[model samples]
Target: MGDRATLFPVKHVIALDVGGTGMKAALVRADGTLLHEDRRATGRERGPEAVVAGILDFADELRVLGERRFGEPALAAGVGVPGVIDEARGVAVFAANLGWRDVPLRALLSARLAGVPVALGHDVRTGGLAEGRIGAGQGTDRFLYLALGTGIAGAIGVGGRIDPGAHGSAGEIGHVVVRPGGPPCGCGQSGCLERLASASAVGQSWATACGDPSADAAACARAVEAGDPRARAVWAEAVAALADGLVTGITLLDPRMLIIGGGLAEAGDTLFTPLRAAVSERITFQHLPDIVPAALGDTAGCLGAGLLAWDLLSTEVSA
Candidate 1:
């Protein structure tokens, strides 16, 4: 009994990462270790109200689990949501994936959790926060974290903080024009970085070139490795566009590191080797930042939410 009691965490926080399709959540100890973790569908097809209700219910379940296991409720909670977020105001300004607009997420979660301090954050920014503090970018003062999944997005970190910018949309690097007059983006921009280099973009390009609708980026990478000329061309084009956008980012941000993650990054050296060479060739006088893969994988956002909750707890104690 004594041993079991001693194993229980003295304090904890709730962390939730809400995405378009699903949510990842955790109960984390003060020292940044997860005590419990869970995943649930977002059910966005049911509408935005249902998604909000789902988040609240999931959070409540986590809190109850924490109390039962640790003998107390969590000290604080943090949520990371996609799209334009007003972290300062705790509002989800707009999220097309979940169809949220001007949702007072933090306040609602706080109330649901019985006044527990709640912190709201942008999803990519929160994930970058985790990568910078405890993952690949740990100990680095400046870095850019890029996720290249179905779409592309970025998080800029400076001095151990994720810059939210004036409007909380500072790191929308995907929208940067890379190949003007090229393919159109959902954002209404033609030849945006994401449209040219994201995983979905690569898949579309490969499918078109190979005349196989089911072909994807990973298959393209495998074909490249196998010395297929068409696959190589497709891969090279995506890499070139990505390098162009990255060069622009490097010139502007001058980060010490560039951490790449997401489904596309799974190509490992097939992506990094060519990407490094391309970025290097484009650099004129800029100091080259170390390009690396993200260490936390899919859990970065949830862990980052934990960090936010911990930060909130610290801020309250100081106050």
Candidate 2:
């Protein structure tokens, strides 16, 4: 057994990104190479305990695979999860979508992996770290990453590192009130940016305008391409509101680049053309930052999880 352990490969780490409905995971080499990738249903419908069990089972399988295939278990592990995270304490405080509350994820993972080091991070911020270090924000010193999905959220990158803020909630631009007294947000704010400009918001607006309850942002983008005036109007409204919110972010962060990602960004130039013009039109004293679409798409979060694992290893080595 000892000789077999010595023969096992020891060059990889496990990275996992747990989402609301699914999970993406990988065995990653130190040079950022993905040796293996896999996906699984999060199975939230089965309840939170089941979800946690599934994650542990999946991770353990990967660890065993590493030992069999590479001759050794993974050196470390990193996991990115949604919701409020106490990163300092390695606890997942609350993830509404996952039905998680105060889950000691790092401790659980460490124990499951035979005492391997583990790092836990917020999903958006982890993705942002990838965007800043290796994705769209690479080569830039400072940037703001906005993900305009079901609900808007942001990440701040400074000097090649993502700033988690003093309270672990730094880049929550979605909660910024863009339209005072316009619409009530779940966060107790009226007319929050996400309520106006998120993909869900666009889908709702388009659904109402087109008289199709199932219409979504993609449908709206297609209609705009087809020159439908109603669709154009709805798209314009979202773009304008997004511009207002982005300008607010720019004035404060002054990022050299603004990296946009998420579902709405799939609209391609349709969203960017109007959004760029609107943001340019709105800025006064703030320097206009270069706006670009996210390059890594859905893979950013998984890759960022790998980075977190590697960072953990590096930190240990240096210490």
Candidate 3:
């Protein structure tokens, strides 16, 4: 036995996305291979402190699980979360949904996880990176990966890198005010793209139109399938708002492809059908990028964070 440590691969990374309801974690190889995966409830209702503890526990569990299955400790951890992040500073400035403020999550995780290099990124931007590098945007230099779910956000990819901008708040397309005075958003803004085009908006708008407070987007879609005129109208508004946002993006970035992901993208043709039409209607002379659904679904963020960790490792090894 020359050197037992030399037998193992040079790098491994844990990708974790801490959400309000739960956390998604996966052990990934340098080449973006999935070595293992684990999920656990966020326990956020118990408060922010408890949520952090739960994440630490879950991460520890994964470290043990990955080591048992693959025979090595994780090299690094990439934690993705929603909020106003100062990526360069490795801090979560504010996360409204999580009630996180001025939280040095990277430092916290780093201290807890034994000085393993920890990278923290915005959840949506990280997903965008994954899409741009390995999934639908594998070959594209310029692309926009948009996530339309409970909220709306995007990843702006240029020259094969996701640019999170100076404030790490670059791709907040959802907060772009479309209507001067429309529905209120969780961000405390009115007429945001989120209020107009998000999955919640589609369902809520439909329910309100139909004079039923209980109906959600899924039920509204069902109503649409049953030919409910009001449901159709609500869905149309969402499609139109999304298209408007897309048009703005195209005008600014001129990306060659637009990747749509998240829960609403699951609608398949129901989304693409009218979305394409609306986008086409807005563009007069410019060429429209191919709008396609994201290939990796929700796992894009996990895979992307792993990719970032791999990148960090490679950079260090070569240096």
Candidate 4:
């Protein structure tokens, strides 16, 4: 290790959002502006080494772009992964989607990127942080951020900060069993909320209701608009299941708001109208929190990773 730590204060940090299908990286300024961005597919089944290599390569590209565009390569980096993580120690404790266990992600990243201080976090939590502080959950102290895409996941935030829980699995609303031995989940559990309320679940349910497994969720929404009985039943089930779990969260945490973010959230009123109605129908005693779509869209996680990098980089620059 070089002994010039004090001399080379990194002015910025690169941020990466690692997902099952792809990873995104960006060089961001202190004001949350991305100066450079890049992405690569995450061939996770190729093994951990290959996935880490791809991330490092993404970092290298960011370094070059940052130096050319922002006058210096980022002094540090922050990565957000979609799974259980020990952010305090920079280790990826588990990634069910990637099949990783006890990976020293921070150490690997630091070594690969040449000793830059790297911060690691749970992707959903970071995305939730972004939404809570700058997007739909902004100005709210306690809120739930839900992502309804290929899989269901959520971020729990209170007072503008996401709480990863003592085990880094605090806001996994999708795993709450709703159907109880109904449909099998990838987690090997039956009738989890994700299998009932996720985007894929929505598509699958509608298809089954129509006796056609090829039904597209979007197309089904269109059919529902035209009063298709099968589409209405499928959509209604998804909404009801979501509301079941949402009510639990609301009763337990009493959050001030709920921010729905992800592919299904993009469905606009098609999803929200029914979901809001379902949740409202179930609530009885407490003041129901506002439900709104995430303002940052799919860019939330990347922006949040950048925000983390920026926080650490600012400390470095000041020191």
* Candidate that beats the other on TM-score, 2 or 3, i.e. the better one: 2
Residue 23, model 4: Cα distance from true site in angstroms: 1.2
Clashes of 3: 0
Clash number for each model: 0, 5, 0, 1
Best model per TM-score: 1
Tens digits of per-residue lDDT for model 4 on 28-130? Answer: 6666676566777999989977887787788877766666555555778888997789888889988777877888988988887778888899988888888
- Assess every candidate by TM-score: 0.96, 0.95, 0.93, 0.91
Preferred candidate (lDDT higher): 1 or 3: 1
Clashing pairs in 3: none
For candidate 2, the per-residue lDDT at 104 reads 88
Clashes of 4: 1
Give the clashing pairs for model 1: none
- Give the Cα lDDT of each candidate: 0.93, 0.91, 0.83, 0.83
Candidate 2 achieves a global lDDT of 0.91
Best by lDDT: 1
TM-score of 3: 0.93
Better of 1 and 2 by TM-score: 1
> By how many angstroms RMSD does model 1 differ from the true structure?
1.9
After superposing all C-alphas onto the true structure, candidate 3 shows an RMSD in angstroms of: 3.2
